[model samples]
Target: MTETALLPGPAVVASPGDFPDWSQAASHAATRVPDAAVTATWRALNYLCAAQLYLNDNVLPARPLRVADVKEVPSGHWGVCPPVNFMLAHLGPLTAGRPPGSEVLVVHGAGHAGPSALAHAYLTKTLTLTGNGPGWSAADMRALAAGFPHTRAYGGEITPLIPGVRYTGGQLGPALAVAQGMVLDAPHRLVVALLGDGELETGAAAAAWTGQRALLGSGLHGAVLPVVLANGLRMGGPSILSGLDEDELRAYFTGLGYEPFLHDGSDVAGFRTVLAEVFARLRPLGVARPQPVLVLTMPKGATGPEQVAGRRIAGTPAVHKTPLKDPARNREEFAALAAWLASYEPAELFTDRGQPSDLVRQALPDPAPRPRPAPPVEPLTVRGEQAWPLVSAVIRERAAAGSFRLFSPDEAASNRLRLAVSGDGMPEWASEILNEEICHAWLQGYTETGRDALLATYEAFAAVNTSLLVQHLKHRSTRTVTGAGGLPNINYLITSLGWRNTYSHQNPGLVSAMLETENPTVHVFTPADTTRAAAILTVMLTGRDRANFLIADKHHTFTFPPDTIREELTNGAAIWPHLSNPGPGAPDLVLASAGDVAARELSAAADQIAAARPDTRIQYVHINDLTVLGQPDTWPAALPDDTFARLFPAGVPVLLATVTQAPAARALLAARGETARVRVVGYRDPGRPLPAADLLELCGMSATALTAQALSMVKEPR
Candidate 1:
């Protein structure tokens, strides 16, 4: 075996003599050789999968199986392994002829089947060839086997740690949506998302089927190949789709704008033939209009042990994980595990060096190199005083460049942002779906692939996609550790806050949920005015590898000086000198506010407080980014202790008004070890519809309440 020199960074370019052009030869050989090579590869993958879960040593057993070879605590799912392995085997040959500069990315919806991904990665030499892990030799295989579920080199599920895996679908339902986003506007890319039938029950997955409707008029090139790995069992019981026959399954998918292709795995050769044909038809540039879906139905735990301890396991949920619970301690279970491991005949598929044999090697495709990012585009020239206008300007520029998209849950007009239109009078670069999950998925997928996108939704409803956002945060974090180039930030324009909305539309939990993560990459920007919102929006668009939540108001609000807001954006918070009384070392009180509406009330309170007590020295501080209030160790954007002291002097009574729950601000302050006597006022949700001002008054966020609170705090003894 030759050592393949990997590129310096995440991008792995192939060297001259690294990978032989085996596609042509393999294509010609396929005419005469029955699908034996593919079968061999699949068998090898199955053996590796089982080995990862059960074996701690003797990876390629040459003697009689013994209990010493089994792991003390075998773990990992087995039900979805065989089918995933089967798909990888067929995909290798099918993707061999893909055009240059194209990619065949796979998203494992059933992420619990991590063993399958690891096995495939090892077999194809992806881990070694790409420099993501150790070399694919006998020693490395033994080390990997010993590591089992605790390897630092790989995660427990499909993760960025794996060379070929991009999206981690441990939280089911986003796989299809993420895949759709990846293929949007990318014509040469073919993203195959392997989804379990159980995952289809998720609301996100159910809504993802309608994503095609959003891309109908958009002249994008790439297509998603949804491969439904129907094993007929969920985590605990039979899957809902298991009751549907072939005809029903076809109709179900066909109704959702897909050309459905059903493959019954009973006949391996027949299924392989159909899979190859489908791949060939969908790999072309323009053939993915309607998109293609392959519903491959196989039994759960297809090639694993059929029975353990005299209980049927295969085709049942019992085989979901570690079919033989204690293979190392129980003699009967150990024998069954040994038989299962022997069924794949590891000796025939691997050489004495533990490397994949010639037959298995010939069946896998060369690992695709990571795509280099497109050259940086010039920053868009945006000019506006209002939040919506500023956001719209950025959108228009992105739409014109054909690289920016906006996914909104039918709130573009409501948010006062004009949707861009193409020459054909259709919405261009803007997709409006009523489902927040779908909108979030599209934006996530698009941005993760290096494109720019933003998801706009009402503030109250933004929490609906909190789970998706968290998953993406984890994905970006893992990708960063892998040295993969930074992806565009996942930006969410959270507008129409609960302050001005009716009873049912009042909720600020999204802001709190994101703040709770305390993730360095999570930023919550609560710009005090429209000018600040525009400046922050521009920065958010250009930022990388962070999740930004921009909470603003669509209605006309106060405007601040552009330069002042620019400076505020940089420091995350700044004292408005013009709105405060200039005095000595420390002011008698510090009045702080975040959010446009909250700032308006604070500004009014400052004027009243000044008139009432002319001699009282007061400082007005406007917080543009809420994350800055936290400790710098937890959030990079957090204000430093020195800067914080300068803006918020010690022992100065501070009255803070925010748009989110009061506890959120208190938590950040506590994290920063702030000793200032501070009283926080924010949304408490009156629980029913009321006038905006009345609601603010009830929540103790009105100007009168803030003024009274500030006066009492200032009058109190130091």
Candidate 2:
């Protein structure tokens, strides 16, 4: 880690009346942060230079800036750069005096200007701490500057897919939620969240803002200071919040119970002073309540070029991206770009050797050791219909040990998780946010912050967070490969499956979509019974950098014994030797099942085959992991062909009863090169409002249908 201390220095102070109309004035006289402002200006220059490289593929001062150097397709947003740098500037001085080893996290919500974040990290040498050696020099900086907005390099957005990033940025509205999760139980830590003003228009962002109600009076011990980068512009036009005056903005946040502090960048010194004061007042005093603060009125493109091509750029929607794209075609625009780059005076900010000067180093926060990973919780022992009850016991145990949280979108009681609710020996163990997006934000935020947590929701509605799921899975996959420590296994307890609901709720497409990605960090566990679910949850809660989905029913169901569960969980599937009828040789047909209902139906089908056709030979295999049926190379849980053959010999007809979509099952079999021979029966329709038993038959997922399908396949010649 690098040793950097940001010392406060003199700054230019402006009166409240100096700001633009509709912007609020500072409450008190401003304090100066000359050093921090210099660092901020230096970072703003880097961001602008990076944007130029991404758009034109050449730096401003470089001689012979040519059309050939310009990228065919310029990418990356530049409008938000000024605010991103502005917020980070003040954060440096705030963390400067903290004790060594204190935890301070900066979660950037605007990721489109990912290069800005990369630039800031590089300048501070935080990139080096993340194991990116040689990133501190001018040569490396130039290399990094030229690579963004290109698929072959850093890509266009900030993602956990890269080392040192704790949150995902391309997708808007989840950073605050992620921040909330990180601060839980760590009263001494400070989590600063920077959200793009335009992103606040998103429903997820609104949900996350109002959802802070759950944080209040909940005994949480961390501070979340949300800095809204109020740049007033989205991608194509003005944001919804951009039109509101300072009073309206203050009222909006105040209505949500936050003590909003207004800041205008025209007075950067004043803004920094207010920001420091806010942190000082909110620093945890061992309180069990949320400390929420908001910074409003951040101008977009505060200090870049004023205009280009006879069009106003700075502080306008036009600045949302590169102001002068295709610079090779226009000599005047190219000249303007060069002059703009020179305005930052980079030579004064950096030493001749390319490293940041002492002043810059002093303005940068020191990097601490990566947070510790979640400890493994003891496995729960309860089985049978008591599976969920045992889960409640485990929740109590984990919550008592601290660092455990449970979130639901108004489905806890429906999912039979009442025991894990607040109180009942599990204070703060559960929070019902009533909105899937909000719940997902909380779950992702909490896990990203180094704790264990789970979200229970209807299988159908789990798709509400489809966008979040995809990004989170990608992030987890990155964490796994990069050894990006500090993330915990994010578990989704998906119940109220499609089979038990009508058309409105009968959607099992999430599983199929997840399978389509085939992400190694994503695992689907359809445990046979409550006991198996308990066992699966035990392993899931303690796992790291993975998305574990446990699909089971909320109703009472049959369960297999512990012995079989132990053996099957090892390879994801195992034959039920006692129930199988292989005779002295291999069976004539094989029956496999996944999920609670599918397992029961398959078991019943086996009994039907035994009674009606005494001479038939049948082998039964239960699937715990749906992905295991695929080739091992494609899926980490996949069973080897030889292991698969042990249950289904070559030339034998196979019938698989699955709760997932038919396509997903077939896709897995196809990956194993068995699709041509295997017959799959799974949820295939928007079910009618019927009894549970009738619903199964309506979709041909019952024992009678399974038996008929099995017998027909068995009778056919291979």
C-alpha-based local distance difference test score of model 2: 0.68
lDDT of each: 0.77, 0.68
Over 4 Å off, model 2: 1-74, 99-101, 128-132, 149-153, 161-163, 283-292, 370-388, 420-426
Candidate 1: give the clashing pairs.
186-222, 187-221, 187-222
lDDT of each residue in 1-718, candidate 2, tens digit only: 0001122111111231121110011121123236455454546445544444543444423454455655665667677777776666656655555433344567777777566666665666655321346356655555555666545434566655444565665467777777776666656555677787766778877887777776655563556677887777787778888888988888888886677887776666566566656755563412434445766575676667888778778767767777767565677777776566666656566665456766666555545444444455555444334655765555555566657788888787788775544553324557777788878877776776667888889999998888788877766665555566546787898998877776688888888888888887778898888788877887887777677888988774686656788867898998987668888877888889888889988898899999988888988899998888887898888888889888779888888888888889899888777977788888877434677677788777889988888888878987
Q: 1-718, model 1: which lDDT tens digit per residue?
A: 0001111112222331122222433354356335888889889988888888888788888788888888888888888888888888877765665544455667778778788878887886766522345567777677666776745767656777776666666467878887778767666556778888888998988888876676666654465778998889998889999999888998998888777889867776888666655654463222335667899887878888777767888877787887888878888888888888888888899987888888887778765554667555566666743555776676676677756788899888888887654242336577888989888888877887778888889999998988877777777777777787578888999999898888898888987988998878888888887667776777787777788999988884677655577668788999897788948767899999989888989999999999999888999999988889999889898998899988888888888899999889889999877635888899996867899889989998889988888899889976
Give per-residue lDDT, candidate 1, residue 339. Answer: 84
